[model samples]
Target chain A: MKKLSILVGVVVIVFGIALAMSFKSELCPYVTVSYVVSKGEVRNVQVNGTIVPNSTKILPNNTLMFNLSDGRTEMRVIYHGILSHYQEGIPAVVVGSYYNGIFHAREVLLKCPSKYKVAEENYSTSKVLSKG
Target chain B: MDIGYAFLVCSMLGILASIASSIAYLRGNDTRKIVKRANFAILTFTLLSFFTLLYYFLVRDFSVRYVFLYSDTHLPLVYTISAVWAGREGSLLLWLLYLSIFIVLSTRRLDKVTAFANAIMCIVAAFFNFLLLTSSNPFVRLSFHPPEGYGLNPLLRTPEMAIHPPAIFLGYAGMTVPFAFAIAATYYREEWVKRARNYLLVAWAFLGFGILLGAWWAYKTLGWGGYWGWDPVENSSLLPWLTASALLHGVIVEERKRGMKLLNYALAVVTFDLVILATFITRSGIISSVHAFARNKEAYAYMVLIALSLLLGFVVYIKRKDFFKCYHSYRLRERLIQGSVLIFALSTVTVLVGTLTPLLMHASVTRSFYRHIEIPLGTALVVLLGVCVVAYRESILRKSVLYSLAAGTLAGIVCFALTKLSLASLGVGIFVFSLAGVIQGYSSRKIDLRRAGAIAAHLGLILLFIGVMGSWMYESSYTNINMGVGQSVHAGDYTLKLNGFREVNGNAKFDVVAYVSVYRDGKLVGVLHPKLIIYNLMRSDRIVASVDIISLPLEDIYIAMGGVTPQGVASFEFYVVPLVSFVWIGSILIIAGGILAALQRREEKTRKGVVDAEGEG
Candidate 1:
């Protein structure tokens, strides 16, 4: 029984590791870029770029956009979700395939500067106005 | 006269007195003289350092560089005093002071012939003082003093910041007591492990509370909606905590059955090593963290020297096992001891590997040198732990194995349903392990409450894991709306109406408050007021979300919004978190159980009989 339990534990652990590796492979793919006349889906490639908000001229609608520094490559993301508290000058990670000259990001990660302000003050009020 | 110079000289003098007294006691026949003088010197040095730092902050002395960088006159008096520990140099000084004070208190409380313990503690105190006097003196002066000092970091000006660091330092400094006792146990050839177990429990409690407080501060203040990023600094604190936790359990085995004596000694040494390592990781710029202090080469050199010396002592002591072998003849119940040792070794390895992985990756070696290091070590650790919990209940291997499987399956099912199959299916695995924990707890008849605390803590980890998984996977969020004072928006089965926003100006910050009402299923549930703060000193801003929570037995409806917009539209995010409160509540129970275990006096009537039985076994 002891041996059986140990074997089960080991198998469960190996299963977990295999699942992670496969998930990573499927989610991350290498792709080569082409100056698309239209949209294209590329596989397994790393893309680096800076983030710019869409409609920066308006108040609160500063939806994040990735301005790829490599030539004129760019992606405007109308995120199907909420905008995190990320701003300009912060680093971001985006993973997805390109569609019709635009990068359709499936996962977006933003690393914001750690806030060191004391707890008493509320920073959310300014966030609403800024979000607009 | 420079206050910095005065304090530096006083600290040096106190170090000399402590060392001289400790050596005298160690070498001489009479220990009373050395012990009394050493304790008094430690107290004097602590008071002197405290007052000097206080004066620097209270007077807004910009001539002192530490003060100039971390404090200002406009800061509140409470925060001004806390500014003493708000920066690197001052915090190191605080660490030294706390170390000395703890040593002195421990000396006064001990009545036994503890010359060896006193000497070891004094040496540790001397090392900290030397570091302060030479490398990271808080009293250093600036060549050109500015008129006003830079204010404390806006985040650190909170009450939690003031309380948390001191509590953590106390916990860290408190480890020296057990370290000293262990040394004394080795020197005197006595079973001091039993007595020192209480100190270990205390240290564990303080460190546990300190970590929890830090997590709470991060959750509410950072506006990150989650706690615990598994950052290096957090992991560093956790390393000592993990070892100390294992040692706390190991000590129980030693006290009950006189097993794993050598393992106990190694744990004590490692616990102290972790303290030094944590300090080194935070103070040195080797790793980037939210709490990384300014790097100083002198401080780094001092820490390296101390670490090397402690490591050397450990090696020499372990090699000459002759000193620790006097009690080796007494054996513990083999199965219990083996199970406990396995838990300790597994936890220690997991923490050590987790802490060193990033460093190994960034080392100035070939990439392949560290390629195999990034495996999901935490997952393996949790599984091993699951096994241990199941095994702890049964004396026989067969019974334990059968019980573990049954419990694991039930836990897995519950976790799957709770997490709602978000992201990776890891929650199912974790849930199975946690279910085993509940079963293990129920099966133990002779419930060692300390063991109960350990079980509770494990259960808490499982709940926390589930909560994090559910929030990450199944949780949905969205933002972008323009609403007037009477405008409304629908989110996740709820409608939020922007009632209004008001501006509130405090002495330290300006707040823009948003008031919003929520209706669920056409019934008004509650109101939430989140704010955005503009700190006057740092000229920085942060978004503070107000959350109105309707906590059910199984899940929580957490509503938080940024604030009311200029057009009266309020922007908000709501989270339907499952089993979130269990994480916090379980942690409290764990701490309470630890305390209960610590206070339960050993059954004095059974002690001599157990000792005799150990001799026979």
Candidate 2:
């Protein structure tokens, strides 16, 4: 019984260490837009910003070019693939890298702000809903 | 007073009734009478409040803010009725309504066990009532009604809404049953564990159904050709579920073997507390999720306080040594059960830690982080499933061990040859053990519902794992292409030819549909219509992709149109996934099995009564 307890303790400790180490490696999650901008050229950075409406252009090659603004600065975002929800003026989170002043986005998550806000607000009117 | 005011008054009355019930239980005099009255008052008022809200929705009363926010006058009647829980405040109220209903339904008899459970439930009801009354008052009146109201999110306006959220809330509320029993067992000197088994199984089944429903909705509407994305909100629900899964096993060990008593108690309390944590993650704005909730510091603080209280209660209970002591020896089957429980415990911690990481690092935990844990841990779990079955009551003999290893190796070889994917091959190999386990369970003569349920549920789990392995291993052919009408695109063995296009206009939305023909190895398969719908609303313009899918028994051919340009060029992405239907089939089996197990011939009532009476002595 004592040995079993010791075994359990060791397993928990090992898992705890693995969890801590995961944060430092390439397996580390993407940083936010502010974090990426603060530390230039970090790969797999996740930044949240609003797409500048009317500034979206779908190139003939199917690459989407749009301008994203984080309230302070606007960065050019170049993405390959269809982002069906990339409507104008909607907040979006882009996961990828920033190189040579352009945000090379791998995945673009459309944060359709107002439509979802109404539902959340009707549920609890305390805090304003945040852009995902 | 208006219905809204009356609703508020009723919830307040529920609070008073809860307090009265708790006091009566503590005093141990006429506890049954007081609890019954309290239960009646709470349920009646909650039912009235629910009906009043439904009435407001049915009439499209734009004067009510919740009605206006969720339902527009032009909305279809079905969706309008379902929109009652489309908002945060409405859902919380709905949760409380389910709690009251469950309380009324579960406590069929006025016994000591029921009274104690009811007292605990009252406390939970009081808390939710307070939350509804303060932060999420469903009856808040608007200063003025707008000319037109915002309609429900086009995503949520589905048939699934009629059942999904309600089932999920019932499961969440039903958890209090086991929690009450666990708490009572620690202090009340009663045989509460036996009674808890039914409620625990019921809640577990309902939660499973809710999750499956949500996944089905996502598959139908999200146009992603996938169901689960390991989103924080999804993980939050899964966290409690994992612990609850462990609790289910732990309680069984406690009930029969007189072991894992403390572990069972801990799991029950943790599962209930984790539900609060899940609510906090969704409602506190602590983490960003697709299902976002309005952040309220007071609500978040209340959640923390509740969780802390439960934690403190657990700590105090564990201080008593006998509760934590194991009274049985570590036999082969016992070891397997305990080991599986331990694995589940580890998996739960990993998920909880990953889900809460955003709060710590201020960045979301990536899917890869989960894979790092899931890949290894999930593999171990699968392997252990086989181990438990093969090594079940038999001693660790060299011959049997070799036979098990030989079977696993053969399975691995067959899987590798078939799929040509290594990780999937390993998963398949482990699944063979699960199949054996099921066979063993059913091989017995005159199998009862208990044994049958366990067998069916385990087989379902095996099928689920196989489906996951197939999809993960074989889903490699995919492409994003833009082609004009009459142009063809080729992806591996399949060729897609754009045939035609059409436009359909609606009152609230417009759809642009593209007709595409699919050919496999020069043979015509089918024509698919993939459409993009753009919703025109006052607040936001939402674009949703309606996917066209060809679902076969073995695989699914998926197509979704991104958008069409003015030059007659249509952009669409297509992919094929193998054995995805099995995920749904397996989930159904699990739910059916759980229900079957819970409903099987009631545990000898007189025997249970004798045990309870003896325990009391």
Candidate 3:
């Protein structure tokens, strides 16, 4: 019984090591452009995109529909992040390589409308009117 | 100037003290001074670390990147405490603190036998504290400070999230006690093994409750109606649980029969080892589950080293001829040993292989490794479990083969008729077998409460299996047209009439409520109000499905609305699941049985003159 147990243990240990070794290389891969990066940095580029209402069920996290006007192509980007309200139809940049035929965006930034300018103008007008 | 560095230094000192004191105490040397110092150091370090993390969260210390990332000023007090464990570093620190606290508590009231136990506790504590200092230190200072921190994960903001990890950590860390006791028992005479059963029972209850709480949290929080997804993280938790459960039962046999001593010891060692391995798999990011931490090489190295040391220690203890000779041997014990080893071996293999297969498949050497290895291994596990059940029953019954076959066949037929399930459903078959095991207890005249609890647990498993199988196989789900107010849709045998959707705005979020009426077979069933909640900070949306369930003894009609489209149509999905309630019912029974088993009468003679000490070494 002891010998058999030992044999089983040895077999499992070997298999486990073999399994670990097999996955070691791919476990930590270099950040490539096409890997949809979420909330992290990649190579040096800062990429961003818009959250579009998706109809496909296969997209588990939902795809971000972005337009690349420079390239004149509509790009469907798959990203994993909590999409904010300003993220839709806002100018954004993605900082990753287009790898495996998909554009991977990392560190998304949403451009906000000029609410500060409007507030400043309103404050000045109110002060001038009060003086008059 | 930062609390992180101070906490780190304190923990490192605590680790040194624990190790030194443990060695001195175990050898019956002058360990009192060092042990006292270690106890105080551990308490001071843990309290300081905990409070510092809490302070970071409460103050919304954006200067500390971790706190800034996981907490915000707007976060509630409950979620603020939870944010302490929402990240990799903080979670590890929490584990360390909880383990140290438990060790200190357990060591305070120790008998002479508990000296060895205390030493083992100190060793385990030292391992964790060392891990804390070396890898994934929560006290690591931020390179740059930010004005405001990122908030916690929207999903983790649930109440269940607050309790799940802590409960799991308590259970995982609690297993160290029995492991320490096992090591301690090896030094003492055979009588210590009998006394260790009570401690083992306590550990078992903790681990079992923790696992259940986790499953409950997952079922409710994950938005997936089913529990037990067999995900790698879930499997890692279950692996220790399975071994611990088996060990709990085996200890009962050991205490009752004065047999299976070696088996009991082996179980103790393996259960402890599995706990470490589970922690490693989860924290080291060997598995790619959402719940697991991201890859951290230092954390991985620390875990591997700890795991290797524990493994080596276990191997040395088991292989030593003196250790075997210390306990009396029986020929009948061989079967139990074989069974235990087989189950343990199979579980270890299944978990290790299942967890690492994805990584292995992705490795450079296995560039062509396209197929999944876990499926075949899982199938093998199922087969082994089947064999174990048969063998266990055969050993107990010792009946004629013909009679056993006849009984099994009759039981199978009755189970089939009762369940009204086809043979194609393997899950149903397994559930039937579990039920049969429960019924088998009726004929055994030596029916005690513990045995009954065990039987109830088996019955619960059967119910759970049936529930999962029924929900998976026979469930009917379909999405209908998105409806407006006064719009109705047909789903399966039910027509869902959309009463209306009302949007309620709150202080921090807005909730879109969908009220719908269900009519099954032209008879009014009920109304369901599902909501789509939009949070303020992240502006993230979550669909909280409100299910109106018509539960029966054999089946359930569960209904939920997907939401109304802009076109004024309400979309609804109705699920007709068989034996769904039984799953939750079974889980509750299993938990209750575990509690009962934990409270089982301790062997009366073993409780004499046991001394409780103050503070663990």
Candidate 4:
């Protein structure tokens, strides 16, 4: 019984360490377009912003190009697949890497417009963090 | 609208009175009479409030705010009925209605233990009632009437809404019964544990099936051709069930009562608290999900509920310290059960941590993070499941162990050959071994509901693991395929040919369909028509793709169209997945097993009562 207890304890500790380490390695900060630009060559980060109107173009290969703005700055986003719910002036979270001033997105998630959702005037949380 | 609000307020008052009377009964100052009457009155009032809201929805009363926002005259009758619980306020009302009925049924006869539990439930009922009356009242009236109403979301116009939300809410409400009993068992005897076990099973079953139904809804909607996205809301919904799954194991082991009795009590409180946490995540919009709830400041009421539950759990634990002050050496069976419970707990913690990392760490972790930690843990669990079966070797055939190992090894070989992924093949081996343990439960003639239910549920679990592994590892996807009419493309070894396009103006919407045929080695295998549906009455301009899935004996073919142009050029994604059918089959078996295990046969009840009454006395 004591050995079993020790074994259970050991397994929990090992798994716990693995989970913590992987979580750290995999964590990507949500940043604004300005922050990404300031950082320069940011890898594995997500930027939350509203899609800029009349700035979307569908490449012949069905790749989508659009400009995303966090109000203060705009970054061009190059995505390789459909946005599925893309609309002008809609909030979106684009995840990938930033290099040479363009955000090449591996994934795009659009926040669908709803009567229920409160229209947040800002998507930037970096300012609040620095202030805190 | 006014009447509904009035009934809601009355139900809250009734719930408070019931709590007060239950306390009096526990104090020996009153009979269970007033408690029973108050519960019945609360139920009646809640029923009246819910029906009044449903009446407004059915009548399409545009003057009512909820009705005006969610339903229209053109909405189908079933969907309109479902729309009563579609929004935040309406869904809370639905949850409260189910809670009230369960509360009334549980309080049919109350002793000191039961009366205490009845009080705790009344407290829970009062909290929901208060939320409904103050912040989230579904009966709020509009200042002026509009000519028409904004119909339900195009995404919610399907038959899925009519069932999925309701089932999930029922599961949440059913959880309250066990939570109350677990708290009551803290200072009292073990009687509450036996009673609560059945409720736990039933609630756990409902939650399992509800999640599966949500997955089915997602699959039908064709989001990334994947049923699970590990979204925040999805993970939150899964969190409580994991803890409840722990409690499900804890209850059976705690019955010996050497020690570990407090385990169930603690797990039950945590399970119920996670339900509140799930609510907070879903409605408070603390995390980003495709099923985003609008963030409401008043939804912090649920945080208060969690605080209350925590306080309630500790206060009872402190008061009952003497009851749990004994220790005994654990048997091998008990130790094995403990090991599995620990695994369940770890899985819960991992999910809960992953879900909350965004809020606390200011970082987002994607599906890969979950897949990495969870798959290994799941494989370990499969191994633990095999070990745990040895504790119940009495009911199992000794020969079945050898048979299951052979079967499992064969499965691993086949998996290795098909996917060439060593990890999946390893999973197949352990999963089949554990699955054999489940089969061992059935091969014996002593197959009662409890044994059969456990076997079936575990069998479903093994099948689900196989389905997940196979579907993920073996599926072949061809994306962004643009084909003109009569054009063909190769999808793995199968050739997909776009045959033609047809438009049908159904009563609900205009359906633009693309006919496609699948051929293997130049012989036709199946025909598929994946359609793009544009609903006319939806408030939003959205075109939803209705996916086509053909289930073959060995594999399933899935197709979804992006759109079809006027010139008959079709763009779509084609996918074929091996063993995806096991996900659904496993889900159903798990769900049915939960309900079956909860059933109380006639003879066993009397015998159990006699045994328990003497033990406690």
Candidate 5:
């Protein structure tokens, strides 16, 4: 009985893993924003860049169009989701593919700018205090 | 500042003291005084270094690179304090400081294994101090002070952020106790397992609470209405916590029946190694993770060190394999309990494989992969819990099994009829049956704290399973909306209205607050104020979703703002999440169970101490 149970457990584990593999969704491979723009026909690739803030426009079918730039190259991205809490100049990672000069993003991930890098020193302490 | 010089000097002294204590222990001399003095010096020096960093942040000293990187002059006093560990270097220091304190506290027992444990802990502390002194030093001065400092992350400004990292670090540092005991068990004795068990429970509680807090923070702040993304960084933490949980259960079996000694020792080594792996993965840029801290060269060194540590642990296990030779077949209860632990261990392996697969391959595994493995394994674990609790009498076990089968079939039928989701229905049926069996077993006992804690914690799993099933399988989300002011939109049975908007400026941030009203069947439910706060200095905006929740006993109406237009057109997402509160309530019970178990152990220790003292007298 003990041996049988152990065998049963092994079989179940293998079956579960196989099932998971069958149901597994392919992850988008990481690529640069410039690379995505250069290729212009890549499918399901992850691109990271800074969001060009004022470029965000709400489109007709729950879709959003924005420009993402990596300091050197910029690409227009079409995302079909709620706008995440990110603004212009914040770095973000979008997973999708480029087609017809536009990247249709399946997912958008934003990195906490303050958490990941030092915030810029443009605004002075007095300006912040004045706002308060 | 001379403070850096002083901190380095004192840390150097701590290293000397630690080495001396280890040498004294190896020479078969009385290590009590050396261990005590070494632990004190290490704790004091680590505390001094921590405070020095805190002092820099408090004084807005941009001269210190870490200070300049994490804080600004306009930062609040409370946030300035939290800024101490907001960066990579400072967070490592925080881990080191916690480890120093853990060393001092855990060594106070002065058992026969003290020398060995102290030696192992000191070696661990030395490694951390070495990291602080060289590669990732927080005390490095900038070449020139900038005009203004960068502020802490706006998302991390929450109250939970201040406590979450420290709690998680304490748990990570606390696991060194069991690691040391594992080594000690290999060399000197196995009696230290009792002390090790207490520390394990405490560490498990801390880690569990930290994970819970992180989930809560993510749900509240991410504006993404869901929690537990199973991202690589999150998976890293869960990996070690799972192994440690398995170790917790395995240790009890070892203490009671001496069968799983080898397994428990291996778990300790694996748990500690996994913690290091977690740290390395999170800090190192090996994996592209949004949640990971910025990558640095120190990550490579960490990788090498972790590799060597794992190799060393493997060698030790190989050498001590003879000490834990199992001789006999286990009974049904013991087998069931051990099987459950093995199942948890298997789950950890599955998660680890999935996490590492992304690093090796071009693609990452989706959440569906983990869910596929966890659901059936989780169900099996829940069943094992019931079996272990009732396996004392064969007749009773058989009768209970039959009853559970009948009840489970009935519940499964009802569940399928209601939801038409077969897997979820099966899970619900098994959960209900297990819960009933556990409650019955508890009621029959005298209800000691240990039994009560174990039962409560186990039963909490049923609720958690139900909660996950209900929320994940049955929840509905509506994403797209453009609602103008005073406009009502229908979502399920509820009508949500965009009432109005207002502006508030305070604490160096400007908020655009949107008033959202909910109505059900022409009756007003509640109004939620979701604010968009944009900091003046940082220029980063955060969505402070008011989370207008209509809380029911078994379900919730969770609503939050997506974005708002300047012209009063707002986008809002509405969710009908069922039994989500049970997840939070179940986590509380799990933590309480751990604490109660620890308290029971303490009481037993006191009783034993008194008995030994009286007999000696």
Candidate 6:
């Protein structure tokens, strides 16, 4: 039994370490507009920010060009695909690389926000149970 | 709204009362009557609360906060019914309804462990009721009623998304049966594995069906021209199904050799735990996913549920270590079964790690990362499953494996000749090998319900993987095809002619439909009407690409209208996705196989009972 447990433990540890290593290698750091500007250039990164109002334009070659800002810094973002779920003023997470003073987005994640939100309650279930 | 809230509290209190009564009954008291009454009360109150909420949705009552948020008067009656569980709070209530029903069914017959299992189940049901009562109440009414409700997200208005949540939550609730049984069994040892066996299969089938529906929905609506984007939320849902699949194999091995009992118990525990984990991963916004419900501290409540299950499992396993028997000197088939379990565990870990990297490392791994692990591991799993099934006949092991390898090589050669892709050919080879093994097993085994179900499921697995590989590796896509009226483009032996475009203004929505004609070798096949829909109510007037797919012999011709400019130039994308139909067909086969397998077990148990009674006489 001891031997079997040891064997299983060693296998789990080795596998976990291997997964961590690969995950680290494939990591796409979520950076901000300021971080991208300061770092000069970064590869395979994601930036979450709202689109600058009236900043989105169609380029000559049908590419989309917009300015993504993180409240303080704004970066020029270019995408080569159709933005089906994108909306003005809603935050989007853009995944790609930053180079040549332009953030080339490979994928952009956006959602059309609903007018009403799921209501939140501040009371606790445990407190109710205790009182009962 | 107040009545609904009252029913929720009543259900919670009833569940608590049942738990206490069950404990007293277990402690040598005649509290069975109280336990039975409490269980009835729970069912009544849970049902009343569910119908109360449903009534609110049916009437489009904007005074009820959840109904006001998710349902609109414009929604169809079916969608309004589905909208009851569209949010976090309402879905928890739905889950409790299912749990309470199952709890009433399982507590009908009181046995030695029945009280304990009943207590465990009541506790879980109570937790959900508590959630509905406090943090995420669906019945919290507004001071003044709004004139109309805010409509649901247009993306979720489709038929598949409407029913997907209920199916998924039902499966998750069904899983609690096995968990409570497995844990209760450890208290006083018996063949508790047998009791939970059918429940496990039913829940596993429901989950599989739900996942398949989600995939189909994604393909139809997501406009991505592909199903399964390797999203973290999708991976979380797949986790419990994997453990349940592994547990199915473990049960057969245990029944055959009376060994691997410990492994089966552990798998049950892990399966339930993963369900909880899936709930947390999907509902919580800690991980980036397309399907995140809401981000709040209340989502952490699911974590406490996970810890409770895990802690219960751990304490039970420690205390009942002697109950789980470990046998030595296993037969060859038993060893093969172990290989299946090991491979399943590996795949589960791979998915779990990939799903969690976003949280642990602050980085979500890409689809490429998943493909790297999944393809190789999936291949190994297929090969092992085939080998294990055929290994039931001891003498032909070497011959079958060798023959399967030969068939694989031949498939690889043919695939290479057709597609000229080595990796694609190699995958084809692996698929052929597994199919051969399943066929060989059928040839040897007698044609009973059990054997027939197993073969059908194995065949489904083979077909599904073939679809996955063919669609992933060999799909041909033509993008950025710009066209005006009467323009035509050739896409790999098929020509797409843009006849024209027309605009349709329906109630509250507008659509731009492109009339595209398809031809194969100068023969007009069919015309596809791909549209871009814009919901008028949306402030952005967002355009959602509605895809149209035409099924060919072994592939699909998928076309979508991208956008139309004012200059009359339109952009479109066409993809020839091969063997995509096999995915759905195979999934149906697998679900049918689960039901068939469970039915066979029930018949076998009855037959055994008759034989034992005859012997006793």
Best by DockQ: 4
Q: Which ten residues in a row have the lowest lDDT in candidate 5 chain B?
A: B285-294
Cα lDDT computed for each candidate against the true fold: 0.59, 0.71, 0.57, 0.78, 0.73, 0.78
Q: Candidate 2 at B102: error in angstroms?
A: 2.3
User: Which residue segments of model 2 deviate by more than 4 Å?
Assistant: A26-38, A52-60, A113-132, B111-113, B283-286, B289-295, B315-321, B390-392, B395-405, B477-479, B506-508, B604-617
Candidate 3 per-residue lDDT, tens place, B1-617, comes to 56765775776677677666666666777676666567667767777878887887888777777788787667789999998887767767777777776667666654545666766676666666666666666665577776655677666677766776776676777777777777666655434555555555565666666667666655544333445655556667777777776676566456544555666677677777777766766544344322122334554555564576466557646665365542534333335444554555555555555555534442111211211233333333333333344333445543433343455466657767776665524454444444444455345434455656666665665566566556655767553335668878787777878887789998756777887778878888877676655556642323333335567687776655444457755555556667777777877677667666656675423332121011100
What does candidate 4's lDDT look like per residue over B432-506, in tens digits?
788777656456435667767888887887888888877876778877778899999887888999999889997
Residue A116 shift from truth in candidate 1, angstroms: 4.2
Q: Choose 5 or 6, whichever is better by TM-score.
A: 6
Clashing pairs in 4: none
Enumerate residue pairs that collide in model 6: none
Query: In candidate 3 chain A, what residue range of length 10 has the lowest lDDT sum?
Result: A113-122
Clashing pairs in 5: A53-A88
Task: Please write out the lDDT profile of model 5 over residues B456-486, one tens digit for every residue.
Answer: 7887777887888778777888777568998
Q: Which ten residues in a row have the lowest lDDT in candidate 4 chain A?
A: A114-123
Models 1 onward score TM values of 0.75, 0.91, 0.71, 0.92, 0.88, 0.91
Docking class of 5: incorrect
Cα-lDDT of candidate 4: 0.78
TM-scores of the candidates, chain A only? 0.44, 0.68, 0.36, 0.78, 0.63, 0.70
After superposing candidate 1 on the true structure, give the runs of residues whose Cα lies further than 4 Å from its correct spot: A1-62, A66-132, B59-63, B109-113, B142-149, B187-192, B283-286, B289-299, B302-306, B322-358, B362-485, B539-553, B559-571, B601-617
Calculate DockQ per candidate and list them. 0.12, 0.31, 0.04, 0.36, 0.21, 0.21
Listed per prediction, chain B TM-scores read: 0.80, 0.92, 0.79, 0.93, 0.92, 0.94
Model 1 chain A: weakest 10-residue lDDT segment is A118-127
Off by over 4 Å in 5: A1-9, A12-16, A19-26, A31-45, A48-58, A66-77, A84-92, A97-103, A110-132, B109-112, B143-147, B283-286, B289-295, B414-424, B539-548, B602-617
| Model 3: native contacts recovered, as a fraction | 0.02
- In angstroms, give how far residue B539 of model 3 lies from its true place: 6.8
Model 1, CA-based lDDT: 0.59
